[model samples]
Target: MAAAASLSVMVLLCLAAVASAQLSATFYSRSCPRALATIKSAVTAAVAQEPRMGASLLRLHFHDCFVQASPVPSLSSLILSSPT
Candidate 1:
């Protein structure tokens, strides 16, 4: 059961990556050189604080991609539109 869930998350990530046109390793190199490392650090910190947070984030990503056809703006709107 856990393995299947892991595979589902991986597949969702791959699908999102493929669907995104401008997505690339160096997408933020010029604009935000430390973006990847910064994200990694944050995720590491969150996971260290609570392992389930990692899975929650992955699920969030999957839903974001599933609901929003586009990546950045839609996801941002989806998140921001929520009542604080």
Candidate 2:
């Protein structure tokens, strides 16, 4: 049961990554580059903190966080993305 939930989470994260790649260019037109840089750094740090995750998974989460910051991609977009 736990493993099934984990697989579901992975599927959702992959979907978010694809969605983010599509949304990022549209949303960042007026945004400051420095702000984006800060977000990217924070995401990298948060992903690095996960002990059980492999490097590729950590990188994917960081990439996803660049645009899909919220777990569900809405009001909480300021928060970093997390991988299960």
Candidate 2 — which residues are off by over 4 angstroms? Answer: 1-26, 51-84
User: What shift in Å separates residue 74 of candidate 2 from its native position after superposition?
Assistant: 17
What local lDDT score does residue 10 receive in model 2, on the 0 to 100 scale? 73
TM-score of each: 0.53, 0.27
Stretches > 4 Å off in candidate 1: 1-20, 68-84
lDDT of 1: 0.74
- In candidate 1, the residue pairs with backbone N, CA or C atoms under 3 Å apart (3 or more residues apart, or in different chains) clash, namely none
Give the per-residue lDDT of model 1 (tens digit) for 8-84. 55676677778756568788999999999999999999999999999999888898767665543443554455555
Give the clashing residue pairs of candidate 2, or none. none
Top candidate (TM-score): 1
TM for candidate 1 is: 0.53
